[model samples]
Target: MRFLRAAAQALGGGLFLTLFVVFILQVTARFGFNKPLPWTDEAAVVLYVWVILWAAATIVPEREHVVFDLLWNMAPRRVRLGMRIVGNLVVGGLAAVAIPATWDYVHFMQRESTPVLGIPFMWVFLPFVFLMLALVARCAWAVYTALRGQGLEAELHLS
Candidate 1:
């Protein structure tokens, strides 16, 4: 779990930093040199997508996502437990369904390349695939812990 979280953080942070540097370079090239790289915009967009996806995948695990738990708090203990299981299963199913479809879509685009960089679309879709896999794992873990009467916070080693 620690390794996976670290990997996500590393990948997301690296991509974000790359995006920033690329933007600065883009600006320098366009305004300073008056020669904007056609490939820069697409590259920046790709990097941004990766950063966002990886970062977003950590929300549930980190408990950083905004939650208005008043409704949850109002629920009876048993009902609350049921809700967590149901919610995790539902979300896990969604992620499971998305995986194959995303794979197919990215595969279909394998023959296609970006106009400027000639980078395969499959390469760009890699981060989305990682994100979907992470979601599936995270949701499954959520369901497992909830079913065992142990919440995610416990698994995460929180007090």
Candidate 2:
């Protein structure tokens, strides 16, 4: 599991690094050389989308996610557990329900290519499908842990 997590982080980092390099090239080409590369703009956008979705899905920890924790913090243990279960179920159920349609749409986009670079749209949007799957898996795991009478601890204040 640790190796898997490290690998996931590395993947996100690589995507981000690529995005940054593309951005630098775009800036340099447009200002330094006075000749902008249209392909760089498209590449940067694609990389930016991939990096955000990839990090959210695989690299970011669950505790790092933004949450409305005030009500959770004030709730009793049982209520908190119920809330966790219900919340996870709602999220996971929706993701699960949307998977087929999302897959279909992504698959259908294979024929369409980006305007500048001509990269297939399917490749660009594939990370969104991964994001949805990750959400379903993560929520399911949360629900399972809650059912097992675990993971109902109070949120810790960072400050």
The most accurate candidate by TM-score is 2
Q: Count the backbone clashes (under 3 Å) in each candidate.
A: 0, 0
Query: Candidate 2, which segments miss by more than 4 Å at Cα?
Result: 156-159
Worst 10 residues of 1 by lDDT: 150-159
Candidate 1's C-alpha lDDT? 0.80
- lDDT, model 2, position 93: 99
lDDT of 2 by residue, 1-159 (tens): 999999999999999999999999999999999999999999999999999999999999898888878888999999999999999999899999999999999999999999988999999999999999999999999999999999998886563
Residue 52 C-alpha lDDT in model 1: 78
lDDT of 2: 0.94
Error of 2 at 136 (Å): 0.8
Q: Model 1 compared with the native: what TM-score? A: 0.83
Per-candidate Cα lDDT values, in order, are 0.80, 0.94
Clashing residue pairs in candidate 1, if any? none
TM-scores for all predictions: 0.83, 0.96
